[model samples]
Each structure stands twice: as C-alpha cells, then as structure tokens.
Target chain A: MTTTRIHSTRTPAFVEFQASPGHRRPVAAPSNVDVAVIGHSGQVGSALLARLDRTTEAPELPGLQLREGINRSRHLLVGDGSVNQQDRNPGTLSGLGARLLAGGRPAVIVDCTADATLPRHYPEWLRAGIGVVTPNKHGFSGDPELYRSIMQAARKGRAPLNYSATVGAGLPVIDTLKRLRRAGVKPAAITAAVSGTLSHVFTRLSAGQPLSEAVADARHRGFTEPDPLEDLSGRDVARKLVIMLREAGLSQVRVELEPVVPDAWAAALPGQVDTIEALREKDAGWREKIVEAQRDERVWTYLARFDGRTARVGPVEVSRDSAFAGLAGSGNRISIESAEGEAIDIHGPGAGVDVTATAVLADLVDAAFLLTRKG
Target chain B: MTTTRIHSTRTPAFVEFQASPGHRRPVAAPSNVDVAVIGHSGQVGSALLARLDRTTEAPELPGLQLREGINRSRHLLVGDGSVNQQDRNPGTLSGLGARLLAGGRPAVIVDCTADATLPRHYPEWLRAGIGVVTPNKHGFSGDPELYRSIMQAARKGRAPLNYSATVGAGLPVIDTLKRLRRAGVKPAAITAAVSGTLSHVFTRLSAGQPLSEAVADARHRGFTEPDPLEDLSGRDVARKLVIMLREAGLSQVRVELEPVVPDAWAAALPGQVDTIEALREKDAGWREKIVEAQRDERVWTYLARFDGRTARVGPVEVSRDSAFAGLAGSGNRISIESAEGEAIDIHGPGAGVDVTATAVLADLVDAAFLLTRKG
Candidate 1:
C-alpha cells in the first residue's frame, strides 16, 4: 500500500488509503453579492486587498466572492475610509454606512480604516441590512453612546456587526466574551495586555533598553502608530478595553484613568512621527522612570483591567509569573476570569497586516453567517 | 445628566452613556425545528437537555425553541445511546440520521455520547442532510476510514459538521486552525498538553504527590475517565492530536505506541476505579520514578507533538519555559507553530460537563447558521 501521510515515517502502520473519513465540502465564493470595503491603502486594508485580489486562492468559509477595487454600486474601498470625487460615497464611512442603512438588496461592508468619526455611522449601516465587519477599534470603544447606538442599530437591523479584531487583533477576545455570555457564563474580570504597539515597546524596555531606544525600535518595526504618542498615551489600549467591557454586558464603560506618563510630556507630543525626537527630548523624567522600573523584577505592561465593578486602563507592574510578563513583540495575552471563576489565558501575535487582515477575513465569514441567520 | 457607568464610582470623569456604536442585532432562536440529541442521560447530554428545557430564558440564538425530553419518534435520548426497548427506530441514530439524508424539513442531531460504534453512523446522519454538532472526540479521532466517511458524507450532503469541542472543550483550537489555514498560514507543528486527566495527574505528580494518590485525586475530581485506565493510556490525547492534525489538513494519523506504564499493571487494572489501590500497589517503581523526576525541576507532562514529518504522543520532560509546564489540572494548552514561524498559545479548561455542554450549544448555534447557509 502507498504511504500518503506526511508523518508516515514516524508510525509504520500509517499507510496511504484512497478515502479517509470526515470530509467537509469547502464553500465557494458567493455569487453577485454587492460588497464594499471602506479602507484600502492602510496596512490592514492593503493586506485584505492582496487577499481578495489573489486569483488562485483557497475557498473561504461563509462563502464570499470579493470583487476587489473600487466600484460603489458596491465597492471594496481601501483608502482612509473617505470617499473620493470619483465615487458616490463620502465622509468617515457615513456615505456607504448610510447606504447600508438605507438598504435595498443584501450587501456587505468590511471596514479596515481606523478613523474615530466613521464608527458613528455603523448603526445605520447595520439597520439597513448591510453586514459589517471590521478591525477598527474606534467604532466600538470611542464613546459609550456610540457603542449603544451601534448595538441598538444591530438589534433593529437584525444583523451582526463583527468586531473580533477590535480587541486583540487575530486573537478571539470579543468572540470569547460573547460566547461565554450567551452560554450563561458571566465574565467576572478581564486582565488583558492587548495593545501590540505597547507590548512591543514594553518588550524591548523589559530587555534593559531605555524607553527612547524601545520606542525607536517599535517605531522602526512599524509596530507603533505613526504618531507613536497615541500608543504611549494609552488611549489605544483604553479604547480596546471599553469595547470588551461593553461586549461582556458591562456597558457605559469609560476610560477611568489618564495615561500613566506625565501629562506635560504627552501634551508636548506632535501629531506624527516627524516630531518623535522633540517628544522624547521634552520628556526629562524618562530615565528616572526607568530607574524606578528597574528597581524591581516586575515588568511594566500597559494593561486593561475590568473587575466587574470597575474598568481601568493604565500601566501596571506584572510579576515574572504573570501571564503578561512573557509577552513578546506585538503579542497579546488575555487572562479572562469567567463567571465560573475559571481563569483562562489566550495568547498570540496581536498585530500585523497579515494577522489583522486574517482576522478581518474571518469576520467577513462571521458576518455572512449572521446574515444567513438573520434570514 | 445621569452617570450610570459602573466604573464611574472609581473615576469622577466617567459618566452614563445614552448610546454606543457598532450594533449587532442579536439573533433569536429558530421556530419549530426538529433537534434530536443522542446520549441524553450522560453529563453533557443532561446539560444539553437542561438548556433546551430552559426556554423561558433569554430568547436564545437563532430562535431555536428546543422541546427537550425523550420522544422516540425523533428523540433527544439523553442516555447511553443503546437503542433500548423504547426506541422507535434503532441503530445509526434512529430515523434522525437517515431523515437528514432523506432531505425533507430542517433537522439537527447533536451527539453527546462517547462510543466508537455510535460515531460510525455520523456519515450516514450527515449525508441525510442533518446538522451535527458534537463534543464527542471519538467521531473525529476514531478509525481513519470512519473519519473520512463522516467528512465525505458532509461534503456530499453539503452540510457542515462542527466539532470545536472535540479538542479543547470551549476553547477555539479547531476554529483557529481552520481560520489560519483559510488565510494561507500553513500550521507547521502542534505541541499540546491536551488531556485534563493527564494535566491533573501531572499537576499532582509535580507537587510530590504519589502516582497512586494523584490518580485517586483525579478520579475523585471527575477529571479522569471513569476507567482511569482510559485516561492514563494516552489513547485519548492521541485521538485529539489526530483530529487537530486533520484539521490542519494532515490526515492518515495513527497511534502506534501504547501508554508508557507497564502493561502488567495496566492490563491487570479493573474497568472501574474501585481497584485504584491495586494499580498503585502493582506499580513497583512509581515512587522511584518520581524521585528521578524531582532530581531536576523538569516537569513531566503528557504532551502530544507533530513536527511536520513526525507525530508522537507520550510522556515527556518539559522545562519551566515550556508551554506545557504551565498547564494545571483540568487545563489544556496548545502551542501551534504556524508556517509563518509564529508560535501561538491557546490555553483554557479542557473538560467539564458544563464546559463541554456549552461548546455543544455554541456549535448548535453555528449549525443553525450552517443550515441556513446550505439552504
């Protein structure tokens, strides 16, 4: 008999057989579905474009046939989510978001842009029967009213807006919380090191490098936001925590504390990486901060914690045995204390164009299923 | 004007929110659908029964109003799965499995049993257009031919079979691999501490507990199989690894080696745990084995590994930094080294009637989606 198994060398008994059990028929691309993507040129956006533009690709689940490139009769836009003069849509996704809210046929919109103004339009899109999936965190975490509005829209639309990538990139944080809630498990607490940008910076800092050096490395490696200040300011991590809290049915969550760094240093920061040097130069106490940090073996991690009654996002010192201690560059780890009081940890690479894009694609599949279920 | 946010009590700036963004219309349960559950009397089965019977609860997902109890015509038999005198149509899951193939109305068959013979009928059930959601590992990790048969039936019937609970209870190991593969990240290797029983045994063993004492503790906690021999045998872990490998597109797996424990000791063991003392007494070298293990800090973990070309399941000494080393009792951890050279770790409770049952219910929601998609 022929030996078809790759690891057949390990076990001689594993011989090739013509037909094995448990086969699944792969789902093909959906036909004539009008889908539009709002962000195209950004990192995650470009990755999604590449995935969709690939000609010879494996079939995807939830069965989507992505017609990449911009054509707003249903388009996959990949820019800053702002509509151009060549299109019928405009603004922070409000154009298509409204289009979805004012729906006719079953269409879809996958958001890859990270603009705060765009998420305001999500409820309308969902309400109009448009399936929405995104990695953009601002949509869910920006304002509590906006968060409720989005959910209310979804409830009215009878659609699902998937934001699994919003919390831990490719990690299934939000989905886990949702499933746990649906299964009657109350999520008691959440301790997550979710910002890959901060994790990368801290990983380098933990390795005896100075804060500036770590920041420089993270910026160079494309892990930090173009503004670097946004990551260091802790706003990114705070937004992510807000989104997660809302999903756990602990809503109306607001960032309880400002960034741990001094306000003067953060306020002096410019809007982009062009001013990183100035931002660092203005921070006189960074070295002193390091000395205080090095006085102990505890590693510094920008953490988001919600203990049912309180939700806060700030820097915290985690010990060697802490799940957050071993977090490497751009990796996220979440230790969830479920209602059963079971503490579980899920870890993985939390950011990257490919990883984030993979999360977006998966959400597309989820949105498709949600659509089917709605029907 | 009202500060309704929970964390508002902690931070003064936090206030109540009127709305939020990114809404998802929660799906209600399906109406008037036929769902037949086999192995209804077992732990997971009973849990499923309780869930179905609790209809006055939250408008459950996809609007499925489960009519729980034993009705033989299309029964949710929560028992040993043996077609008793009460069965209307016996064998191959009664008329339920066959009805799915016949293709009339919407139907579902949730298998909660753990019998090798019972799973052999999954293919026929799936082929009959019946949705199958199961936590039973046997159906997937059993005979290679049977595995292929079930999959072929699913493929031919164009129905999705969900088995996420088969590997890591409520953890998303199978779903993670599926998404990764679909995104073109070939999963390269798997290193997992997959057995809760073994995890318990090892956790105790590492704490200087005698092998016999550890086995007794595990049995008392209900972590071990009723016949602790089945757990100690490593066969369970082997089967789980097979299912994982196949999900990563590596099929034709086989368990070529038996448990490391002496055949004389294991073979002489009784079916139930009434003779656990005899097992400890028969083991003439277990204490010495513990001393050897304690000489160094290396912890013994029942690890299952597949390194692209080789697959092995047995006891191995893991260093402190090893992912498996951190696993505690009833916990499961899987480290996947994907083709992208990323080692991702997923850890959580591996087993429990409640946890496994929760996973089954989630899959039921998924199966409902799959059914809608198929239509």
Candidate 2:
C-alpha cells in the first residue's frame, strides 16, 4: 500500500475503512463488458488496452473483456494474439457490434483514431445499441450534420456516447457544458485556450523564446501532432471551439479561424526541415511582435471565442494581469460566460496519452454501467 | 422564443434543431420521478420546488412529480396543497421513503436541511434502496462513522447518493474529485477558497474596506449566514475543507481551522447589532493587517488546504498574482495538485440558492435515470 504520510497535526488517529467499495464503482455481481478498439495501435488506445488487461489486487474496473483490436489492415483477437480472418467490413462500423455482441455482454467501440472517416460510423454503431467512447475530435467537431446525427442516434438507441476527452483531455469541459445546457442556462460567450501545443508555444514566446524554438520544444516533448502544422495552423483550436459552440446550443456556428501561421507560410514549408528553417528565418518578425507585446505589458495568447453565434479563434494580445496570461506549459483554460453573467473557469492539461486514455476509460465505465443496468 | 440574436459573422444560417432529443435527457417514454423535498421551505429547497413546479414551454426536467414537502412543522402534499396527518415519524427519515414509495415510481429524497441529525437517516434510507440527492453538508462533513456507513449502505443497496453541492455549491468540485479518483489520480494537495461569504469579505477588505463593513455588506447582499458569526467563526470553511479532504481519499483527516475572528470578540457579540458594532470597534486592528498586506503587495484570502492528510483552513496572505487572490465576489476556487504535479483548477460561485438547487436537481435527475433504467 502506497500511503502518503504527513506530519500529524494532532494525535495519531486511524480511521478504519469499512470494507466498503469505493465510490462510483459499485460492488455488484460482475457484469462482463465486451470492448472493441478501433484505433488499437494508437497512443491512447494502447494505453487503454494495457490498463484494461493489467490485473491488480484492487481492481478499478473488473470484467472488462478486450474482445478485438481493429486497425486499418487487420483485426486481432486480444486474448489469443491471433489475427482474425474478418478484416474491416466496409459496412456496419467494421462489424464492431457483431464482434462484441458475440461475447454475450454489453458492447462498446473505443475510437482513438483522429481521422475523419471513423466518425461517420459512430451514428450507425450507436443506433445499433453499441456504446461509443473516444478521444476522437473529428466526429463532434467536424460536419454539423454528422454531429446532429450522432447525438440523435445516441438518444434514439438509448446508448451512452461520451466524448468528454474531445475538448480538454481529461478535464470536465463537455460535462460542464452538458449540465449547463440541461438546466437551460445557455452560455452567452465562451473564451478558451483549447490547444495545449499553442498554449505552450505562446507561453514560451512570452518568456522570450523564439517561435521556432518553442515549436521545436513542444514537438520534442510530444505536445504537438506528428505534423506540427495541424496545431500551428490553429485548426485544432478551431475544432475544439466548434465542439464547445455546438455543445452550447450553437450547432452550426461558423468558426472563422485565424491561424497563428499564415496560409502562405504553411504552404511554403511543406517538409519538416524546410518548416524549421523557414520558422527560424521568420524569427525577426515574431521578435518584433513579442517586443511590442512586452512594451504594452501584454502577453500573446491563442484565444477562441464564441459569443451567441459568432465563433472565431486566433492569436490575440491580452493584458498581463488577465487569466489567459497566467496559463503556462501545455495547459488548457476555458471560461464559460453564461447569459446570466456568471462565469466558470476550468483549467488543466489539455493533451496527454495517460490522461486522455483515462478519460476514455471513465466514459467506457459509464457506458458499461448503463449497459449492465439496462440489460 | 427568447432567442439571443448575434450579428452574422457569415451568411445567416439556421441549424435546425433536428427532430431529436437533447444531449442528456433521452426522448424515450417519460420516467416518472416521485420526489419528496425534505427542507422544502428553506432557501435552496424552495428554489428547487419552484423550479420543479414551474411549467415552462421547454421543460428542463420532465416527468418530475413533486409528491410531498417535508418542513419542520408539516408534511404537505405538493400536488393539492394539503397537509398530511403523518408528521415527523421520529424514525425512518420521517417516513420519507414510505411516502415516495407509495407513488409506485422512482423515489428520491432531496435533503436541503443543514441540521446534523438528518444525516443519521441517510444510511437507513440508502440501505432501503431509495436514492438521495442533497446540498446539505452535515451528512458528509460530520462524523466519520456516519460518512462510512452512508457510503457502505449506498454501495450495498446500489443506490445513487449524490452530494455535489456540499463543498462548492454548484461548481463541480466533488464531481471533479470523483473523476480524478476514478482514474487513480491521487491529489497531493488541495488548495481552495471554498467559502463564498469569506471570499466576498476578503475581497472587500483587500479593496480598502474595513472588516466590519465587509461583513455587513456581505450579509446585506445575502451572502452570509443569518448570524454572521458562523461565517466569521470559520466553522463553515472547516466543514467544507473536511468534505473536500475526505473526497480526496483522506476520509478521516482532522481539520484545524484558524478563525477570521478571535473567540474573545465572537463571544462579546450576542445579537446582530452587537456583532456589527463589535466588528466596527475592532476596525483598527483589521486596518493594521490590511495595511501590512498592502505594504507587502499581498491579498488577504481565506484558504483551505489538505496536503495528503493534514487538513487546515483559515485566512492567509497570498501574492496578488496568485489564483486565490484573483477570486472575486462569492466565487469558490479549488485547485487539485496531483502527485505527478499536474494541477487542475475549478472556479465558480460557491453559494447561491438557484445554483445549489440546480446542482441538486442535476443529481436528482441522474438518480432518477438510474432508477428508471434499473426498473
């Protein structure tokens, strides 16, 4: 037992644990949950698999069966480590529901893929009563029609489709929004720093590091995507803003994305080496902007805002005393300003494999609980 | 329709609210929830009753049947406004479970009382398979034995026991702690400004107001207890700290509170007028401390901290740039620093009747959903 010790403020007192189950995870007869991983080899997916497969004295989630792993080319049986003959079926979410239902238990598809095409299958899978849990942003933040369809399908089938990891990694961003919407408290405006990579880059720039070094550092520390252009182009932040806006009742708001790097600059630096060299060459321009911001006692921040309908995301100069200026490292900060003039701020690390995977597992557990009770 | 209009950032677009249900509340056949409000005439309870009874065009919580209202003197049937013959039963939580069970639907008890003895009924009520939702702090932050029994009974009966409003009103404090614990992330330290009344008082003090004036102002604004001594004595903050520390897995940690006002001064004031006058007479002492804080460029904040096991709460001098110093009005701010040194901060109002009622309703809805599904 790894117990945290502290200096006693009073006499040594031991409070007995009543041999009770911890909160949330009820100590009921074990309900088997058959789970399929769509992006099985990805960072979050693999971490989730490892957590599910590892057995411990005190099990957090018991009876979770890793039925199959479905990647692009193959479908592998998790128990036997053998490649299944049935590959990705073009229809019916690659037969994910069928495979999981074969286990005679609650079925769930864990999508960790960041690709756009996977989300198209979410509605069909959810409508089939197979729960969907993911850190995937493409489904909720992409096409409005798809987002609407996914929500409708989940409701129609009475299945749990949780995408809390889509916004601020493991932070309770989406859950907060859903609660507010449920109570009919619509947000008048939402100001957010949703991209951890961009947050890091801006924090470094504020600390006098050049843009090229900041981008390099972020990528080296695994904060940015494999292609850093995805983060640098501000699409990631835009996507998160879209998700929040949709969650806040503006389902089809236009997000005018103002990228940190210009389209011409992004187009100019296609290759990795060329991108680094080009960014290094453009250091002088960034230096001027940084100096200007410092002179005004302001910090440069990539901000995303949605006020009722107009949604825009880009870099902006904010006061030194502002909350946005206080953010550091790979942290994400979202401030929801409700129509009633109440504001709630949530801050945490917005990107990481462990945290994101844990979020997916939390959602999976909720779905499994619902499945068990409904069954 | 009270629609908020915004200038079109693009072409005017109407994203149809598809013929689908909202995110959380399923559009299936209505699940009737028979609710009995226990302190139904109290501030939070009355607000909750109003919200539950109001028939808006767009019903936020549908199929909710307000069965009975249990106040100090009477048990009134909410539907027809008739008093029931059965008063306080002195046993079985005043027969709350029996009355709601008679409805032949999902039964729930919403405890909005602050008395200490109401918590003793929690274990028995939960063990009987009736769900509980409360904003009451007494049941959670009081005796360790009762806390253990309540949790054990909840798990044993598979009942949903939610107290999210206990610590931070409606700021998602307990929910965040539960999520982190579920993911196996143990918080190393929890630093919080959990008292909205004290937060307002200190904010005023920092802005050059005397302690006496600040307390009076807070009371005038309906932020403090009817008896200001409860807020001034610091016991409320201590109870909140205890609840938070237990939620962070230190279920039996002792909280040593340093009151904002000394015992000598507190005992000297017997009435409301005497309290205000005594506080005014002690203005010189508070002014000295305020001036000293200003000289050091610090802000006076009532902060609660739980470092592993040693829980302590009181007033502290924090730098102006710190998060605690930034809390304004009646907001609560809680920062959970994980063992790995990652910190997540949640900030919002810590005291309000409407928000607290909403928090209780959210929990009630969740409990009702679970019951509906289980049935």
Candidate 3:
C-alpha cells in the first residue's frame, strides 16, 4: 500500500492512489484520450508521443498536455515542442495536485524520466486503470516484492503495465522471456552485454584503442551518455542486468558491479574529467594492455552473468571465437541457457535515442493492444 | 474442414462404431486407454515405455493397449516376455482394438515410429480426442495443411499434440518456437544443423577419416541411423527442418529432399560394404578435396535455411570463425531471425533414444498440466 509520488516543476503532480476503499470510482465509457507526458525531457517520453502521432488508423483522441517542470493544463492540445520550452506553458503540472482518474478512456502516463530516484507509482496507476508504458528499468528491478505487487495491481486494475524498453531496447527480450516462462521453460542462466555504451567501449578497447579514445568514439557516435565516463564505470550495464534478472524471477538478487572506472579520472577534477581529452589523459595505458591481450589471443568484453540464483558483473578476457567476443558496435546481446534445453542467444541494437524510443513505442503498442482486448 | 488422414501401414487398422438410428448414445466417458505404438520395435518406442514406467508417480489409468504392425490386440503390452502375454484379470475395455477412443477412458497414442508413411492417422487420433505424442517428425512436416488441421483438432478437442522429439531430440526447439509465437513474434527465418547423424558424419569427415570409417564410427557410437545412407542422404535433416517450419506457421510447405546418398553405395550390396572400409576407399581421393577446402580456411557445414516463404537445404563452406562452423559434435542448432527482433540461436543435442524419449516425456508432463488446469 506504499504509494510513491514524483513531482514535475510545471504544475501540481498528483500521487497515484492506492487500491483503497475511498479511491473506488465507477468505470467510465470508452472515449477519446487525454495524456500527460511525465519527464518529457527524457528519451522514452519523446518516443511515446511520436508513436501516438503516427497512428493514423486509430480513432483521434484528445492530445497530450505538454508539461515539463509542472502540471497546469486545463485542456489538451495536438502539437510537439521541447520539454524545456513547454515548461513555460501556463497549464503545466508542477507539484502534488488533484487526482484525475483516466477512467475507461484512453488516458495514459508515459514515464520516460531516467531519474533513478523518482518514486515509481505503478500501484496507483494500476488502481486507477491508467496504462503505464516505461523505458525505465528501475521500477521492476529495485525491489522484488514491489515488482510482484505492481503486477498484481495491473491484473486487478485490468490495465496494461508494459516495460519492454527496460531490457534490450528494441530486441524483444522481455517479451521473449515472458513467453518462455509461460511455456514452462525455466531459464538456467543468462549471459549478456546489455549496454550499447559498454559494448562499444569494449569493441574499441579490443581494437587497441585506449579507454579514453573508446569513450570519445562512443560519444561522437552518440552511443554513450553525455558524460562518457559514466558508461565506462559500468552503472548503465549493471542496471540493465538487474532488470533482466528481476524479469527472470530472481527478484532479490543484487548485482555487485566491479567498478573499472579509469584510474586517471580519479585524480582529476570532476568537471575537468568530463571532456574526452581529460579522460584520455587518465587511462592512456589501456592501449598497451589491450595490445598485450590481443597478442595472447584474448579479446576484452563487458559481461553480465546471471545464474538463476545469483548475478555477477565484470570485464572478462574472452577468446575471439567466443560468442561474446564477436559482438560488435553498440549492440546488446543476451543468452539464456536453460537446464533442459539449448541456450537461446538474442542479439541486437541496445542503445540510442531512436532505438530506445522505438522500444518505448513498442511497449506502448503492446499496452494499446492489451487495452483494446480488455474493452 | 478438409481433413487429410495419413496412415503408415497399407492395411487400414480401424474400429467402426455403430451409430444408433436417430439417437446419439450419451458419449461414454473415457474410462480406459487403448493405445497404439506405431514403431513398437524401434529404439524410440522402447525408450518411451521406460518413460511411461517412471511416470508411476501418477498412476496411469487402466485399459491400456499397445499395438504395432497390422495386428489387432485386445490388450497390447510390449515387454521382454512371450508375445501372448496377458493379465490374469480381465479389465473393462480389455478387448478393444487399436482405435484409441473406443476404450471408454482417456487414451494416449504414442507414435515413436519413425516411418514417414504413418503420419496419416494424426488427424484421426486428434478428432477422437486421443492425445498423440510422437518422436516422428513426418506427420507434422509431411503436408502443411495437416499441421493446421492437427492444431485445430487439438484445440477443438482439447487434446494434446506434441512432437518435440521430432526436431531437436531432447532440445526444446519446438517448445521455444511455440513460446515465441505466443509472445507475438513473427519468425522471419530459421537456420539450423538439425541432424545429429549428419553432423557426426561431417565432423569425422573433417577430421580426415575415410567416409566409410566415419560412417562406421558413427554407427559404432550410435550416432547414425541403422542404415548409414539414411543420414548421408539428407532426408533426416529435411524432415526435421520441415517440422520446425511447420511449427513456425508454415503449414503448407513440404520438403522435397535432394538425395545426397554417397555414390559409392549406389551399386554395393546392402551388407557387402562395411562403413569404415567404404569410407577408406572413398577417403583416399576425397582427402585432397577436403585438404584444399581447409587450405582456404573454410569449414563445411550442412545447413537448413527457412525464410518464411521459401526454405533451402544444402551444404556450404563457411569461414571457420562463423557461428555455424564452430558447432561441435552431433549438436543440433537453430537460429531464428524474426521481423519483431534480431536473430536468436538455440543449439544442443539432436538425437539419442534417451534424449528423444525425454522430449516425449516432457510433452506428456506439459499435457498433464494443461489437462489439470482445464479440470
């Protein structure tokens, strides 16, 4: 019954209602939708809007209230604008505000904010029968009990809760895993390179580039976080691994990430090390190390191994012929090995504004389909 | 609905039910099982019996019969005893024939028979609500329409139709494909080395052994079919490929296997040429050919490719570093490329009496669970 509320700077943002007696409301007839994009500045939020706009065959619904820092909209409008600019709109939702029941109408909340600290309001959303589509992995991976609670709420609410974008970007990993579970095949182990940023960095390092150059290359290619060092540090990959593990039913497992943060960055000023040249100066020795590994027939790989009961995260030296060694670019690959069957290896693009957005869009489509079925 | 009935034996073995004029006898509740074992004399059949015996945890309903060939049996029991073995107690429905449904009890017809001709009875068994479990790939793969008919009957009658052993032995290829489909994934392509016998033969050939020696070694290791030519001819792999394709929703495709039977066996008497010696004779000349291919850093692989609309079967030379080239032993491997996501690879054991029987048992357990759920 714990309800978490996230605030926007534009208008009063309401806390999701728990499934309690006073919160019960009559089901409303299906009608056009009015949606609010929470964390519109984030990747997933933008994607959801694009997907809704492209659906020409669908019945025209009331459009979204473009809110950035606050919620103040009295009416919905059809248009696109930057989140920062929309923050100045007079009708944006800002702090704790009035609860509006999405009812039986096509009202949706697309949470695309990457802020890990934001309180996940899955229960509240589910109780109100409002569909939720998110690219955020945190909700499911954070606490096992809460994850199950969210699923239970969705079932009770008869609403869709989709998080496909939380796993393999557009690779369909979550859907695939769900299918396997439904078919009674238990996953025995999961080995993955779930971060495009990490994979690209590894690919560059394996090619004998220093860690700094790899980070710069990833940034130039738009494959890494704005601060490239954040990816090299392994937090991004760790979060993805946690999400995958939770989906596989290992809810309580904690992934211990061995931070291989470049040593040079430790001695530099935080702001100074944010740039590519500063990062390069810190880990220049990685070039020789990578060359040595190549001479010995080993390739550098960022790996996440999830054996049913536990999970581990680290960088390993793999043979060139191994599956992990062959993964290239900003691709993400996941291999699920089962006790009774052959391993299933799924590979594809893992990170990008477009790819991540596409994944979120896919989740939205799934939710929309579920809602249609419910009706 | 147009229904195709495929029968293995030329003589149709059927039991007719007399319909009361203008009256339907209250459909008798199934109280006993009159089963038919199509390939009772084969290894797969023997292993299936072993699996049935282990299912003692759940007592099997009585009135069970096992029939092979054209003979009718009131009670068909296969064991190492006298052919006329009978139980001292005459149970209800004891005199029933091979018609699985007339036994007045839940019936299970296990077709461990590998005879391609026997697939005709699949629809008949399905219509009668008699669950059919088979290691034979022929029924589902023979005609695409038959696959649809079988699935429809299974759903309509709420009967189980499983043939996991048909493609990957104990590996869960069929099950995985079913799960993938249920999750809304449209498979675009399937690439696999599905024949264990062929994989072993090729592996030995790659190791510089004579063709005859490789065949002999395969037979000695129980890797090849009794008739080594069956494996060499590529029919086994073709059947497996067809089954996989059918499972992925291509119910109309039929594979016309190209005969790759070794030319040396064309004129030789069946028992005259020992495999090892035959391979030795063929090896002397083929050695240079294999050596030349290896010199170019190529490895030979027998591959089956299915691209939704069309399927091709052939052996091709691939780079040693390719995924298929690294496959070892008699492993069965399948790669699925789908429109909804990237490619997925599944690989493991393809054939063995124990493994094949295990697959059948797994299907049985699945059916039991489903039946329990329905109840």
How many residue pairs clash in each candidate at the backbone level?
Answer: 46, 0, 43
Q: What is the C-alpha lDDT profile of model 1 across A342-364, one tens digit per residue?
A: 76677888878777897887677
Global local distance difference test of model 1: 0.65
Return the interface RMSD of the candidates, in order shown, one decimal each: 9.2, 8.0, 26.4
Which docking class does model 2 fall in? incorrect
Which tens-of-lDDT digit does each residue in B272-309 have in candidate 3? 66545555655665556557668977656566766666
Report the number of the highest-TM-score candidate. Answer: 2
- Residue A362 lDDT in candidate 3: 49
Say which candidate scores most in lDDT: 2
Per-model TM-score on C-alpha atoms: 0.80, 0.85, 0.63
The DockQ of predicted model 2 stands at 0.22
Candidate 2 lDDT tens digits, A1-375: 112122222222222222112343345555777888877888888998877743222233446677788777766676645545456556535566766667666788899898788899888878888889988888887766787788878866677898899999888888888666655567788888888788889889888989889889988888777877778888778778878876765654677777777756677665646565667876777778878878978778788877766777777777776777756666888888766677788888877888788788777776776776575
Could you give candidate 1's per-residue lDDT for residues B1-375 as a string of tens digits?
011112212112322222243323344434434567777767788897677633323343444434233332544333234444353455435555554434455667777877667787777777866777888888777666777677767755666688889998988788877666555555677888889888778777777777778888888987877777778778888888888877776664443434646445677666664657766773445556555655765566677877767677776666645667746667898888766777668788878887788888777765764575343
The CAPRI classification for model 1 reads as incorrect
Choose 1 or 3, whichever is better by TM-score. Answer: 1
Query: What TM-score would you report for chain A in candidate 1?
Result: 0.80
Q: Deviation in angstroms for B351 in model 2? A: 1.1
